[model samples]
Target: MKRYWKYIRPYLGAFILAPILMLTEVFGEILLPRLTSMIINNGVLERNEAYIVKMGIIMVLIAVIMAIGGIGAAYYSAKASISFSTDLRKDVFHKVQEFSFKNIDDFSTGSLVTRLTNDIQQIQNVVMLTLRMMFRAPGMLIGGLIMAYLMNRQLVSILLVVIPVLVILIAIILVVAFPRFEVMQKKIDRLNSGVQEALTNVRVIKSFVRETHEEEKFKTTNRDLKEGSLNAMKVVITAMPLMMLMMNITTIAVVWYGGNLIIAGRMPVGDLTAFTIYIVQILMSLMMLSMVFLQASRAMASLKRVKEVLDTEIDLTDEQASEKSAQIAAGKVEFKNVCFQYTKGTEDLVLDHINFTANPGETIGIIGATGSGKTSLVQLIPRLYDADEGEVLVDGINVKDYSIRNLREGVGMVLQKNVLFSGTIEENLRWGNETAGMDEIILMSESAQAHGFITSFKDGYDTDLGQGGSNVSGGQKQRLCIARTLLKKPKILILDDSTSAVDTATEARIRQSFTTTLKNTTKFIIAQRIGSVEYADKIIVLDEGKIAGIGTHQELMETCEAYQEIYYSQKDREKEAGA
Candidate 1:
């Protein structure tokens, strides 16, 4: 509630004015029935022509005023609601941006998208309804009942039965509708997830000829969404018909009783006519009130979902760092007695009892069999995931001590899966250092061995990439990513099998450039191919999340069994290829 007020406070004027203006419309509406009763009783029945003209003109003027008020109400309500949702959407998006990997893992991609869009939209709708109806509905109900009393006091008895029944029906509908709406929102998340996955991996789906499989998955989610929506709306749908039935019954009863009163000369015909319309207006206002409550109930479900994201405690934050000004320099990295798990309080550790040190300017190679915790080890350096047991240090300071931005800015990493946004090639490369000039951009591209193919494109550096760089080959994508990271010129660099798609000749050229141009940068090379990391200053071989060996090529060849096995297997493969 407090968090939402921040957004509301800015547009408080519009919020307050909307309902206030609506009262003018409601006031005019209430007076119309009373004015009609007078026009009939004093003018038509008594045969007074000027009196009829005067009252009719007054009614028209009141209607004109009512229309102006309604237009003003609508304008303010729309302004308040749109502005409120815009700010709320922005904050929700910012909060998601601040979420740690673990916090993000707790909510799926599709769920976040729904919360940012559909959930906030629901809240906005409620705000618009509330702003318009807050005063209008109640004003009409109270004014209508009062005028009805003046017209015929005996007619008020009918409301005692009708109001309570409609209120009870509305309450029952809301109670059932709220939970179903929540379930419906979750179904929307599934639908969105299915669609996003299919579109993003459409290439994979086509290559494997699994379009039918994807369609089936979409159909299941789509069907679930349809059923969920119907369940939610079903109760809300019942409200209108039940209210209309009661409305008709109450109208008939009022006319039946009031008609008798007119025949007995206890009430005037104009009074009976006015009384019937007042009953309808009163019932209509109740219906409007019920609609407002129903919408509010649905918006509450969305609010809860939105709150989950806003209230999420990001497990990773640098708020308590001792050295706020700490920055990474010299690039010395060490892991001491480090233990980790993707899930905490579990015996199944991803990396166990890990211990290693890489001095500044040394090229450290990390080779491991699949699922040997290669990526997990390097991720700790940037504090992507905190160590469950021990500390990860950079330049002698705990990685946690340095601010995340400071530590990350000094360490550049190219993960196994390369990602590129939809933009020109030059715009993509500038992500490393936005201030970098064209000369620096070309220099890094040459070092990554990407300049050759990049220039061959018609637009060269200005060539626009498709989403996720789909237009480029796998090898070209890797080289572009390499160049992008290189432009950072960080003290520490990690290339996690980033060159796997590039041929050995180009890969070697990139590595060679590192020694000459980036001699001072400590580089961590993670690869499956032995030759990729064979000539490093130090090679660390991992097996089942443990360091099997840590030494240069010849040193590991003699001392480590795991290292010997890997070397012989690769040498045999090379021999076969040679033949």
Candidate 2:
């Protein structure tokens, strides 16, 4: 509640004004029934035509006042609720942006999306309803009961039996409905995940001829969501019928009891007429109050889900760093007896006791079998994941000492999976350096060997890319990503199997450009083909998470058995002319 004050404070005037305005309607309704009794008893019985006309004119004025209050109340509630939701959604989005990779793993992408959109919408509806009915319903109930009791106390006693029964039933329904809503929300998360996965990989599903299998899988998730929603709604269905039954039964009982009194001459006909209207008003007020509670039950579940994201403790931050202002310089990287696992407390290590060093301006090539922790080793330098048991140092300082933004900006990585946004080619490249000039952008593209194809397009650099660069070929996408990273001109550059899709000739030219354009930049290239790293200044051969060899290509073939096996197995052995 204290946390929500920021969102509510700005709209406090509208929040307070909505309920106050609703009171005018409550006063108008209560006064209307009593005025009707005056018209019948005083004006009609005495045959005073003048009095009847005066009362009619007064009643019309009160009705006009009620309409104004009702509209004003609606305007203020809308003003408050919409503004509140907008600010709340912004804060939730900003909190998500602060999440570390590990923090994001705690919740599914679908769940976060649902929380940001659907959950907040539910709470907004409740806010509007609560403002309109918070005081209006209770005011109607008390006013109606008082007027009815004054008209004839005996007739009002019928409500004692009906109100308690309806209250008990509503309480029971609310308790049963809450857990069902929680389950329904979880079902929505699964359905969203299924839809996102299927659409994102539509091409793969088509190529593999798995459309039928995917359709069946989606149907199963959709059916589960349908069942869960129906299960929750069953409580609402049961509740409405019971409330209507009690209301009708009480209304009939009141009229029947009051009719006997009228015939016996114990109660006036005008008083009985007004009393019946009051009975209906009291029952309707009870219904409005019950509805408020019902919507609130669902909103409570959403509130908890939203709070979970805000309360998450990020595993990575510069909060405790002694040197938060430290920057990466010279690009000398070292891993001292590093040990890491994806899951903490697990004995199965991804990189076990890894030790390595790359001097400034050196070209370090890492080659190994699949799942040899090649990607894991380079990721540590950027502080993407902290090593579980050792230190990763950059420029003679612990990587943790530097802020995450500063550390990552200093090390540019062209990931194995190339991703591009739905924008012009120039826009995607600008993500590396937002202030880079057009001339600098073109120079990097030329170095990456992407300028040739880009210029051949009719729109050149202004050509719009589809989602994830879907309009481009795999080889072209790889070069664009390389060009984007090159625009940063970082002290340390990593190519993680980035050129695997390009032709050998183009790859060689791209490598050659690096010598002149980035002569002082430290480069780490992880490759599957030995030819890619054969001419490197230093080559590290990895076998099962441990470094098997560390030297130039020629030195590794002479001494390291693991390196000799890889060298003899590859087509590079042919290129070396039967070395």
- Best lDDT among the predictions, by candidate number: 1
What lDDT does model 2 reach?
A: 0.90
Give the backbone clash total of model 2. 0
Clashing pairs in 1: none
Give lDDT tens digits, candidate 2, residues 248-363.
Answer: 89889988998999899998778888888898899889888888888888888888888888898888888877777887779999989999888888778889898888998899
TM-score of 1: 0.98
Error of 2 at 181 (Å): 0.6
lDDT of each: 0.93, 0.90
Index of the highest-TM-score prediction: 1
Q: TM-score each candidate.
A: 0.98, 0.95
Error of 2 at 570 (Å): 2.7
